[model samples]
Target: MGEERNRPTIVVVDDAAEVRALVRARLRLSDKLDVVGGAANGAEAVELVRQLRPTLVLLDVSMPVMDGLEALPLILEASPGTRVVMYSGFQEQGLAHRAMALGASAFLEKSMALDDLAEDLLAVLGADAPVAPTSPLETQHPAADDLDRSILREHLERFREVFEDAAIGMATVTLAGQIVRANRTLAALFELSVDDLVGVPFADFTAASATAVRAALADILAGRRRVVKIEHEIAGPAVPLQVRTTLAPVLDSNDRPLYLFLQMEDVTAQRGAEEELRRSEDRFRLLVETVEDYAIFMLSPEGLIESWNAGAQRTKGYTADEIIGQHFRVFYPPELQESQHPEHELVMALRDGHYEEEGWRVRKDGTQFWANVVITTVRNGDGRHVGFAKVTRDVSERRAMLQEREATSAALTAANARLQQVAEDQAHFLAVTAHELRTPVGVLGGTADTLAAHWADLEEDERDELLAGMSSSAGRLRRLLADLLTASRLQSSALQLDLAAVDVGAVVDTSVATAQRTHPGAAIIADTERDLVVQGDGQRLAQIVDNLVSNALAHGVPPVVASARRIGDEIEVAVSDAGPGVQPEMSERLFERFSTGRAAGGTGLGLYIVRQLARAHGGDATYRRPEGSEPGAFVVLLPHSPPNA
Candidate 1:
């Protein structure tokens, strides 16, 4: 198709080579319009229009030498029929209609889309399009909205003038997330040219920020989060901007969010102030809470209760509702009621800062809790006293517990004294019994040995009877003496440890031989391992082993087992037998003096003496029922010490 003869010829003028290239390419792509030529400055563009005689001149407002604002008249005078379209940047703030009144056909922003540019050019060249008069108002009339729109447009133009010229950052965005306007303030903030920023999406300026653009959009869309006043930090090509955003909602006539008005103020100083205030409050709260033993409360200026915590209720024994607003005098005992002068204290807190005292205060049930009171005045930013903060504590419970513990300790001391007295008495009785019986039993045991030796000289039957009688009498005397002597030593307060290394095998061997002589007819088995050593007095240790073996033979039916072995660093002397095992009652009292196992007849000092001597030597004695013996086992243990010990 042949190009339409009436299509307007357009000339492009700009200082940037890129601007001339873009406009020329975009305008040339149109079938109806032809891009005549291009220039890098207003002077060149003016000469191009005169030489080419194009239908229209697309003039850039900002250029070197002669600016479009200055070249407009010249371009029109050179070609009077040319429809001049003034191209401006986002930062080109002043209204262009005044220039249009001179000769220009229309105004276009440099950031407009290529397609939009084509459409605008076509619309401008259409027949019957409205021509520019010397003024806008003298040309037409419109309804209320358009009239309001015009007035708002004027306001917007004035705002743009200030934004481009002022030394601050600013922008205008619609609720639908569109960049409706911008100025040099925003261009400098984003480190971009005015034309580069005008039509670009707000998100593009903050493309590196993950949620920065989305967050701003949410503030515009969400009704509840409207007017997001954030001290946002945004990074641009040059530097990071620490900006305080005061976002305001500009509502339409229907009270709907239409325009998001954002005013940015740098508040790095205000941030420092808020942080200090927050830290101070945190420290104060920490101090108050750390008063572990005190009940702190806060009251309003009129003395109305504002808060009560666990301590307040515990110390005063009054719930929040019961005594929150009640007069503090309720806690003061009647005696100190007037002397305390709580009202005067409050007045002092209001005038000065704090009032501190220690006294007795009554609880909810009329009992007195010793209290330490501190009431301080809280103040506001203006330094006017706001209210009183009170701290109180109950020391009564602790005092009572301490007294009870002291009483218990005294009772325990008295009981201990009584036990000592009883022990001394028992000791005296045992000592006397042992001394008295020792002499008589020693004589009897000697006589029995003599009679047994001389049995061969008597008649056969008479020898049997004599031996029987002597053995019975001697056994009784020996048991009685042993019991008394052991009991006496058991009650004594003082004891001595003669921890010396002694050969355990030698002791067991000697004890078994002694039992053999003591009970000739009894079957007593003895076995001692070699080199089994222990720490104890040799004499007392021998006595301990002898007692265990004799106990086994007397109580055991027939077979008595005696063995010695090494266990860890100690020596174990075990005596077991196949006899009536120790009963439950016998097992408990079996070691008690004068309480022999049931069915056994003895003074019962043997086990008692053995256990005491074992403990004295830093060892122990134990009885266990052997598996096959049908009787319990008895083990006498002694610890082995160093050879030098």
Candidate 2:
């Protein structure tokens, strides 16, 4: 009777067998509550409570045969001191009040947690009721007697069942960090059974969170904190689990730390959701902050600036703080703002979801730039417009490049027009040259016929005169044709030279003799240095001297002087005539093709050929007045070394 009185005797009434079993199982969590009997209905509950005379009757409101509201008064009448706790799946305040009026001590919903129901029952039993003694492992205090030992065993069994059947992972770890007891939930977390988890170190399963878990345990053992809760990973065998762990020190009566009570909740899904949200924000921030080519930003629905990114700062030359909250029309040019273009863009974007345009825009420093702008409507999940996402790009450099290309194309067109005029001029010069060839040819033909037909019938002097006339005409014709051939070769770039060592003074004498024979009226004199050797094509050098002498005889007063001398490393050959020098205006262009002066019988190609051949032999040709303003002198200078050198 003493032991039975020490525990609170209770009767459980439920219609379902599973409900009675669950109530019995949960009742085992408290050793102080002893289930005396069970009834399937309220009428049976009243009989059971009266027969046992238990301290409490947990009656379900709904039952077959008789309901709890009808049996409540009978149960209380049979055992006047019994506390009747009415519980149901659904809560009705009116019914609960009626049950209370019928002598029910407490009303509770069946959906309420079993642990809360236990607490409510304990509260109704009061502090004077017998409290279960601490388990033998929990304290060093020995049991006073058999009753105390009996209470200790009951309490230990109750705690053991509660720990082993918990929904979440639970373990009791000694101060040495060894797990002395672990529930099925904790063992299942590591893919092991409860027996296999005991005696294992709890730190082994939390390799990654070892330091944090250890520090938390230390704080609890030191009595600095009652509980430490943290989220960490448990390295299970199959896959790691994200767990929210709570570590609390179970204390003895003297406040000494006994053991650690650990609760681990698998939070992998919860943490994964949080991580996904974090990465999504990070990706959005990275995309907006890293773009440099386009100015990406946001504006309020009313076209006021709202947000700015790195691209907007770099492209618009305005910092985020300076630009945000300002009207977006500040980016438009003065005329565009006056015409309400910014407002128009927003309206179009709102209507069509987007707007794009290219036009002039103003920068922060008041300079204008060409920009490609896009305004995209930003909407909420409900499809209501919230703002505009504006993107702008400066196209000033591209526009300038296109303008420069147009200018270059126009310049090329004008240059082509000038080339066409030059081509026409060349065609007309060829025609005039062809007409000049007939006179010399006709004279030579008539002179040759006269000399041949009347050789014997004519007098000696007459025959000689005809013969001389024929010879002069032939020389005239030869000079005209040679000039034409040389000009042709220069144009074609096919004139070939065979170079050798030669005495340039001898070349000068031969060229002078030929010039004198061709122009009998012009007295030609040779002034040359002896043994003045130079490297050149012998035949080409003679041609050079001959052309200079012929030019002097044709254009200047006699006598024409052909002279050669070695000056420094070069050989200078000068042919001078006593005549007015070249005109100042024509001097610069004297060596150009078709350039000429007074005499016009021969083709105007002599001076041009002279200059080209001289340059090919690594020398130059020039016409200038001698010192003291004497007659014109045509000079040719050749290197003393061989042409190869």
Candidate 3:
């Protein structure tokens, strides 16, 4: 009667048969408590606890028949004094707290200490003895008396169950990285089993993961590193596993570290799937951002700016802050609002696939710039419209430069046409002038030769008259030749003048004398001047005066007069004749090349040579009407170069 009264009854409840069997097998030999019955569901366990009147109930928190919480109130109603110890696979803090509030004695994890469970039961039973361990490895379990053999068998079985059926991957490795044990999970992952894996180095099975596994094992054993976790991918001919390996210290009784415990989690398919999606997004963004020609940015389907890029900032001159949340219509001129619909175009882009156009875009300052723009719909994987992707480029400078080039080309074409016309006109003029000049020169030369052939046979008086007439004709020929030579050289740009200071009065005197000789019947007057000086070639100055006087004699009717005078740093020389001054329309062109007063028997070159010679001396000549009651004057003006110059 005393033994039966002291004995305490305990009930074991779990959803798994293996877990119940492990508990019963380890606790059956206990002298303290009697495990009356075992149940696989919470309801059945609660009924068993009621029928047996057990002192303590070990109940599974998660069960198919009824959860521990759901069966708690009924179990207590049936046997109000019964103590409850909740059993669970998860140590969820909330579930444990709830169980305690519902009158459970304690919450224990499924893989928790059996020794602790034994102690908890004794305390609930109010035992006076020291706390007992529920583990069969306990010293009081009788098997402890044969510790060596008992521990050997218990440890081997414990290791086998833990490695084979723990759900999570588990393994034991020797100090040299050999695989002493492995679970079915590892075998399934690597296409190997316990027989093939045991006693083999971990690298043997993990041929692909050899490098990393070897390093991790070395660090744990020789380097004393523990609890190191690393991601690994093992590749093989028939099997591959992307896994996470966590290494831990498994020590002996003396507390020195021995075998390594490595746990693995397969993340191959999950991680690969995530990485592929991430890379696809990264590559698409890279392509859009790296486009050099198009300034791409994000926009709302409502046409508000969403984001800006480097190309957009460079092209549009607005930073992200200034443009973001702003409407696309800001890029249009205010005048366009009344007539154009850039906003409509944006709407069209959202409804359709995209909008493309070449037109003018306004700058921030309201200046218009030519631009090429594209606004396209940006969407997600489902093809639902998300927003707009806008690309803009400023092409104002390019278009403006193209227009300028076209205008330049047109100008060049017109200029070439003018040059061709001038060439044709020149050809026609040369032919006509050559024909006209030949007739007069040939007739005069014939006249001079006939007189020369009969000079000796003629009488003295007659010969003297004839010779005088011949001489005058020859002089005329010489004058014509000189005029032609000067004009030809000037036109050909081959005449190089030798410039020097000359006495202006002397040049005048020579020209007057020559004029008197050439026009023997006409009166020639030389006005008095003492000394007049100028800077010019002496011969060129003489030729200038001679040409002016000759021009006057040929065209003037009477009393041609020549004069020279000093006026400041210059000399003014004049030849006045009673002649037509100039034709009104011909005044500007009179000093031009091949210009003269006489049309018949004239190369139209005398006055042109006169003007050219004067200009070469850095002086000039012109025709002026006489001041008061005087003949029309042909005046030559000379400026003396400075003494140093």
Candidate 4:
């Protein structure tokens, strides 16, 4: 009980349960130190220190809930007399100084042996604790002299084992720069055995870095520097090797440098990797700078232009000196800038990683062009939004071509619709023509048959009637055949006009006589003004008049009139009747091929042929109607004969 009361009390704190257990067990070996309690982390240790008020706290630097640096002042505030010693795996001198500045009693590495660790903790508590020797050989030997020698031999052997078996290259050099001792790792770096390396000058391994290595060694020996570090290249079997070399003085008891402790680590692979990364960045920058087709640049997170490439300068008509550092909104039109669209684009890109669109963008000269643009969020390795990468391409030509294609497609569709309507109309005309031919053909066949069967037993009047029927049928066939042939010629653009000075009044009178004979009881009139002449084909002109008069007699109430008069520089020949002419909707289509226009019978080709023949003579055909119960007229207008003609 008295020994326990005299011993210094300590609380062991670590994040690892095994470390806490090991520390507590090691404190028992000191016999002059007592383990009062154990805690897993700083927060728990703080509470434990407050409760027990232990003389010393073995605290870990890193822990959950709270860390040692934070808990150090709290623990001391809780127990003013308690000393806290920081334990960590790191051996950095800056961390040690920082811990000491934070009022820590001492900073010890976790790599320290258990016996040394207990002694360190006890020293922090102001207790002079003699820790037991770890070797069984020292324990078994009771005599002081034997124990002293045994311990000295054990320490030297341990030093030798550590020196020869280190992973990095290690060597012991004389103050004069000669290699006194070298480990197998160090020998392998120079591609030689330890026996060959000893007694040789360390500078002899590298011709280029020999002077630098000697200077560093001299500095350590002269006490100007306690440690020296440098990166240098050494000759190798295949290629040159890079090494990080550190030199420190191995001091004697008088604090004078005895020899140099050398440490070298192979860093060739690390150097190669850094060089490759730099080259890759250079290549990327060159590619972006030389591109002329696309405007690739960078923008800050606030939407200000950060970088301008050559491509951006060429495409935007701005030099790098002129445009860099300007707000990216400058590329937008005034309306978009006023609406803050450029700012909104950044927000959207940040949210979704990228934003892309094709729209109008303004250039330096204020001209607008269609551009395809992409804005992508740029992030750092830590995933923080840094800026944006913008790529713009002008696509105005492509857009114009697309619009032209769409317009051409619409025209083709309309033409196709008109062709389809014409085809339907022609089919209907063929069916009507077949019906019309059948009536005439049947009439002629029956009339002939009747004459053949009844000739011997018939009266003269019956025979005369049969002969008149045959003549009418034959005239009908001749008219139908002529109209068909003329229509075919007009369709094939093969119609030839005979040009001459034609008497329009004479053509009208002749057409009227022919129409009256065909209709028999139909009332018809011919009215004319004298000296109405036109430059036209006379036969075609008469054909035009005849067809109009015949159409009026067939489809109109009687008093069908054919009239010719001079109007300005043209002659007008008109055919009109008293009947309601045609329905209002069919007025425009009156002269279309196969348009019968309310006619009860007859082929629908007369007016179509009339307009075609009229247009051939540098003239036109039109329909005229006066309002309020007035009659409609099909009028053909022909140019007046030239003065010379």
**Which lDDT tens digits does candidate 2 get at residues 1-645?**
444446778899977666676676557544668887999998888778778999888888767899888898899899999999887764335456667788888887665655455668877767444445544432553333343334334433543576679999998799878899888888888888889888988888886888888888888778788889988787766787888988877655366777787898999999899899899989988998789888999899998888888888888899999999999999888898999999999999999999999999888988888999999999988988899999999999998998899889888887887576557536645654665656656767776777678667889998777777767767767777777777778788988878778889999998888777766776899999877777678887887888888788777788888999989988999999887777777788678766563235445577888889899889999987656866679999988864345
TM-score of 3: 0.38
Considering summed lDDT, which 10 consecutive residues are worst modelled in model 2?
Answer: 143-152
Residue-wise C-alpha lDDT for candidate 4, range 1-645, written one tens digit per residue: 453347778898887775676567657755668899988888998899999999889888878899888999899999999988998765446567678888998988776655567777767767666656555533665463344344435433644686799999999888898889999999888887999989988888866999998888878777789889989888754678999988887665366777788898999899999899899989999999999999999999998888888889888999988988899999999999899998999999999999999899999999999999999999998999999999999999999998899889998999999899879877877888888799779989999888888898889998987898888889888888989999999999999988878789988988888877867888899999878878778898988998898788777888988899988998999999998767777787788888773355667899999999999998989888746776789999998885477
- Candidate ranking (TM-score, best to worst): 4, 2, 3, 1
TM-score of 1: 0.34
Q: Which lDDT values do the candidates have, in the order given?
A: 0.70, 0.79, 0.73, 0.84
Worst 10 residues of 3 by lDDT: 593-602
Q: Single out the weakest 10-residue window by summed lDDT for candidate 4.
A: 144-153
Please give the lDDT score for candidate 1: 0.70
* lDDT of each residue in 47-79, candidate 3, tens digit only: 787788888888877678698898887788889
- Give candidate 3 misplaced runs (Cα > 4 Å): 1-440, 443-445, 448-466, 491-499, 555-561, 595-601, 622-635, 641-645
| Candidate 3 or 1, higher TM-score | 3
Alpha carbon deviation, residue 400, candidate 3 (Å): 8.1
Q: Is candidate 1 or candidate 2 better by lDDT?
A: 2
Q: What is the C-alpha RMSD, rounded to one decimal, of candidate 1?
A: 24.2
Please give the lDDT score at residue 172 for candidate 1.
72
Question: Which stretches of model 1 miss by more than 4 angstroms?
Answer: 1-479, 493-500, 585-589, 592-601, 627-631, 641-645
Could you report the Cα RMSD, in angstroms, for every candidate shown?
A: 24.2, 26.8, 25.8, 11.3
